[model samples]
Target: MNALPRREAPWAPTALRELRRPWKLATFALGLGWLLYGALNYGIADWDVGISLLMGGLTYLLASWSVGRLAQLRRPDAIGLAVALAALFAAWYCVDGVYVLYHGLAGNRMDREGNFRASLLLYFLAGMIWFYRGGLAELRRDLIRLIPRT
Candidate 1:
């Protein structure tokens, strides 16, 4: 009887990994480009704007580094399935962020919030996708089975 999730193609690069180098760079560029545009057009005239942009860019880079780490772990990864994983991450991040920063986010800084959210949303999504498709779930499933099932 199969008691645990089977590990298939355990060391394959996931779809998110395949897109990692490209997506990370893309998000970084996209975020920074918007930051620059806002500064020039509107004005980096506020601390929140700068802070938000910095966080967004940093997260995208962090997300990219994660993909490399997963490969080092020799995890199995996938692509089409990765999209679902990405969306899951994005949803989680957004919800968590709103929950934690609800007070601050209630202010009238939708522009900065929008810019940063776009970058962070993409970064979180990609990283989670990589983890999900890159054998992360396998590790999780195995761990879950360690518990006594009623």
Candidate 2:
């Protein structure tokens, strides 16, 4: 006999189910925000802008899916995916911070525009950290499960 419990109904769509998790939801939301921001600011008039936004948005969705898989199975490939995402976000944080600081300090007065950009970037970083923590906790839990019981 099958051991798994039967579902009452067909499962929700993959993206919908995965995004039920808070971390996943945050990541997805931020990604959409960026996509919309790009569309609005860049107008998608040029081929480069259109393609870049398309690719970036798709990548974010894939990353969200990876986060969900990591949470459930702690898959080996998912670990690598998480590490890559972490590195990407960390690098972005560093470069953006340096850019904002240099420009903000270059002016005699405080740069409000730089301040706004920095704040948005900080929120994005925080979302990534939150998503990373959820994956890390799942990995830790699975590792402990593998230990031989006394």
The CA lDDT of each predicted structure is 0.46, 0.44
TM-score of each: 0.30, 0.28
- Which pairs of residues clash in candidate 1, taking residues 3 or more apart in a chain or in different chains? 14-77, 14-78, 15-78, 15-79
Query: Using alpha carbons, what is the TM-score of model 2?
Result: 0.28
Residue-wise C-alpha lDDT for candidate 2, range 1-150, written one tens digit per residue = 112121211133634443365655665577557656764785434213333344344444443333333334434465556555654453444334433454455542434465346444643444344334334457468668989999
Best candidate according to lDDT: 1
Model 2 clash pairs?
Answer: none
Query: Which candidate's TM-score is highest?
Result: 1
State the weakest 10-residue window (summed lDDT) of model 1.
1-10
Clashes of each: 4, 0
- Error at 2, model 2, angstroms: 25
What's every prediction's RMSD, in angstroms? Answer: 14.2, 13.2
